[model samples]
Target: MPFKKLHTNILERLERKDITTPTPFQSRSIPVIKSGANVFCAAPKDSGKTTTLILTTLHKLKCEAVGNAPRAVVLVENKEKALELYQAFLTYTKYNSLRVYVGYEELHIDIQKSEIFEGVDILISTPKTMNKLFLLNGVSTSQLKIFSIDDAGFLIQKSDSSAIISITQSIQKCQYVLYSEELHPKLKRFESYFMEHSKIIQI
Candidate 1:
């Protein structure tokens, strides 16, 4: 019944996609995420981790567009993952009012700023790009609600972890969720930065 806890629009989309029966990971993690806690979701591939990310994000936003600033931010490893996740989100958001925007280094900061200023509900980007956006005041965190990192094993790098820490420092308060195939030690270190008192869901 985790899917039932989602927004009506999201539930409708899930039904349309014939996505009933939650994977063990989704069944366990979705409710914890819905509770608005910082979570580290560890699961193997094809266990519906990404779907849980998309579903909980939509549920948090109430499946609708709001202010110009993004309420949800999703961080990925690089441009390819950013674009792939963007497409995946689109399949769920296409019939709803929520607006999803993707950003990476290839796109000019000015263009991203202008488009985001116009309006966006969920903002997806690489850690470096997101740090740059925060530094330049390209996006507002005043309304931010949730910040999730997808396939976060990449954070093992010094540069990427540095960027992520910088971004978290700028945000006042928000839920942070990290999804990965395994719980890397480096990721656990994030408890000091933004994952304070975090919950872990392993499947």
Candidate 2:
């Protein structure tokens, strides 16, 4: 039923993709994510966690492109996942005005910075690359609305966790969503930092 409340653009894309039903995890998590609170979404693989992240992000941005400076930022574990999520997001954005940009360590930060400067709506990158961007002022968080981490289990690594913590420091306020197979204790620590008053959805 929560899908019914999504933006028409998202609904249209869903219909086009023949995705008519929400998985159990999505059924429970979508409405909560739409509420605009920071969330920890824990579900096994193939539970539609990635799909929910995509739909809710587009919904939050009203499924359209706006000013520069990404409105949505998705942190992936590595280059592979970053590009994978970028391609997945493209399916929904194909017919919309939204712009999706993918950045990884392999890509020169300078190239990423200039391309991002052109205008980007949704940005997908690894935590390390994101932290570097923030440090270099390569990406602007002023217009950010939502920040989601796909398969966030990798954040258990001290370096990745530290990078995320650093990235949050520059961001003032925005909805945060972390998707993972299980909620590790380290991830829970985020509540003490930027995830204030956060909600948890475990399936």
Candidate 3:
């Protein structure tokens, strides 16, 4: 199916970077994504999962104004991955007025307990640190629209299920988008929790 028409602002931002064509994964998944369904995309590395996630999130952000703080959270594996994801989001949504924040264990001091989420629209961070922040009331999932887990297999393999469970339970009603190069055994164990009616795109 053709991708549902994205918001004009999102289309403009995508075009600004010459991103006019959807990757195979995007083409197959965008339609379901527009319907607000949970998606699980398992593709080899460099299949454009990051771009798909960022673009979808940007489209959503453009479709509606974010609340007082971030309404989307992206749980990654480590500091390096967090930074990489943050940079990608900035590049795609640079033309739009969206507040993006990156939180990691090393940057705990820089994140204020009370106002860490103030003015933030998207968060990219490790599950452990994000869970801590959520527990400390640094962020809330009540208004969240998107909950993504990039490199999801890695997070599950690292035995970070506790944090993942916490985050998922908190945002139970939010649309979930999970991406991974390969599904690990541990991740397969959580299939019931993350894969209900989820569309799996294998590239």
- TM-scores of all models? 0.99, 0.99, 0.89
* Superposition TM-score, candidate 3 onto the true structure: 0.89
Question: What is the clash count for each candidate, in the order shown?
Answer: 0, 0, 0
lDDT per residue, candidate 1, 128-178, as tens digits?
999998899999999999999999999999999999999999889999999
| Model 3 ranges with Cα > 4 A deviation | 1-4, 63-65, 109-115
lDDT of 1 at 71: 98
Model 2 spans > 4 angstroms off: none
| Model 2 lDDT, residue 15, Cα | 96
lDDT of 1 at 6: 82
Report lDDT (Cα) of residue 191, candidate 1: 97
Tens-place lDDT per residue, model 2, 1-203, is: 87899999999999999989899999999999999989999999999999999999999999888999899999999999998898999999999999999999999999999999999999999999999999999999999999999999999999999999999988998999999999999999999988899999999
What's the lDDT for candidate 3? 0.76
- lDDT minimum window of 10 residues, candidate 1: 1-10
**lDDT (Cα, tens digit) per residue for candidate 3, span 81-185:** 999999988886666678788878888533545455466788888988888877877777777888888888776555588788776776657788888898666
The candidate maximizing lDDT is 1
